[model samples]
Target: MNIARPLLALLVSATLLPDAVAGSFSFGLWGDMPYEKNNDAQTTAAVIRSIDRSDVAFSIFDGDIKDGSSACTDEVFSRTAKTFNAMKAPMVYVPGDNEWTDCHRKNNGGWNNLERLDTLRKLMFADGRSFGRRKLTLEHQDAPFVENTRFHKGGIVFSQVNVAGSNNNRVLDEKECSTKSARSAADCEADNAEYAARNAAVNRWIEESFAQARQRKAKGLVLTLQADPGFDLPETEELDEAKTRGWNRPESGYKDLMDTVIRETRAFDGQVLFVHGDTHVFKLDKPLHAPLDLLPNFTRLQTFGSPNNHWVHVTVNTRRPEVFTVRPVMIKAD
Candidate 1:
């Protein structure tokens, strides 16, 4: 009888062990790179060298591989891809406004934005896999919509959507278009329609990520985008100033996307990390609609970019409740 009791206790202990007690791995996150105003070439090279030296599972460049003021040349995409491939870790990239959305600007060579977007897809992501000597298995949404990508590693689900800054390419006033581009009112009208459709696609992709996370029972979800998605801005006065520009008050563009994201985060059992790069600073904070009051498990990570010229180092551990611990790695911090 005593031997039977000991056998039963052993079975119970074996069944109670937690989900493979999580392992840890680090990865890199950086973007809004090669800005013309900064010490671009020198800084970008240094940042690349630094990442190569570090031990990382993979690296994600959040977007804006070229400066907004530069030409949306095919060469830029190829060159950046080469730089990304040089990293020892796999590289994942999100799309940015400067590369496609704002390519219609006269300074950007007066190119049709959609045409430029097509070029970007062809040159940068045509392979349907990430850049690097070795590639990660990514589930892509595909083709014209190649920017939306998802992958899972170390019990964490990672994804990216093409929500860039510059009001997310939502506004297409003909006058503004005429000033920056030789395109017609008809073309601007088409651009507006494209904006609407893409925004809808982004909204759907945002919701899908959450559903996929739940299905996988992932320990953490990381949704990376290129837009800042303004949060915690000063209310009333300063907010009014910020809101005047569609870029600062993208809630108008992101209302439905944010609504679903917030709803899903509340239902998810693990931590959520919302990452972006347009703001060009290294910021880590709880920017949920109510933070401590609601969605307590969510965190926002804004990567270093432009003048700052640094990258983020994220340590992901399945055993930790937070799932991800992030820190900025300033390659040449002053």
Candidate 2:
């Protein structure tokens, strides 16, 4: 209760504030990797070494720590966790469809995808902390649900969501619900229910993250997801035509998320950085449709994954007019 002791504690806490300690921090992003078992060992080793040497604040592997064709076994999760732990910086990972949603595919061992997902959550996230030898405290949107996490750095709010590609794991149309998977109709129906509820939860979490950013007057907000959401779809898409549903592209399940992103980004007075990895290509641009067409203040960055098997170095600076600068660093495989 002594005044001197309390003042000294306050001074120590102020000095350790995340933003001040993280001024102009950088991070690495990678995903959809370790495919082609023959060469993945070398590639994975090289990429991990690169990240460990990059001297970034931390790294976020957007998703897909393994190939689609691999078995979603306990080994996969544990090995990936070990790989993350090898990084000198803290590592953050979200789920990819390959890890669970699409595990029912015959090529992927035809496991019960839902059960796979449950196991994944338990293995990678049960501790409710980020991966890597160096770990950081994270705020999970829902306790024990590591998919939704929030952290702050350089006055920007950085959040990760478990929204992945393959239509965000949604079961659309009777065809998909009935014959598209190894599971039975009843299993598909149950999956559809999960999709509905989880999608709603993801949308709410996104909105809440934006709200928190605004409340804190963060200079910008960075949202990391595992799906590209296909914002670059052709103008002739049925979804854009109105009065029709677009079944050709992966946009249906992402409409809610896209709407929330557009709405909150528009309302906020600062920049918005959207990062995703599904699609396994590195792309950076502004792509959107009307009413919020091509948001100048919004930037969409797709990270390197799979065959490319690289990582992105992202620098965040809230004091600058441009909130982010992202660069692709292709790891040397030799």
TM-score of each candidate structure, all chains considered together: 0.87, 0.87
In candidate 2, stretches whose alpha carbon ends up further than 4 angstroms from where it belongs are: 1-18, 178-180, 235-251, 290-292
Position 158, candidate 2: lDDT: 83
Worst 10 residues of 1 by lDDT: 242-251
- Evaluate all candidate structures by whole-model CA lDDT and list the values in order: 0.80, 0.79
Candidate 2 lDDT trough over 10 residues, lowest sum: 241-250
- Count of backbone collisions within predicted model 2: 0
RMSD of each: 5.5, 5.7
Question: Distance (Å) between predicted and true CA of 178, model 2?
Answer: 5.1
Candidate 1, residues 1-334, lDDT tens digits: the string is: 4799999998998667543343578899989989875758888878888887898878999999888877888888888888888877799999988898888888898788888877887787777688888788788774567778898886788989988777776664656668766577877777778778887887777778888889988889999998876765555554444344333344366655666778889999989999989888788988665423656888989898887888889998888777788888878632
lDDT of 1 at 78: 85
For model 2 the local lDDT of residue 184 reads 76
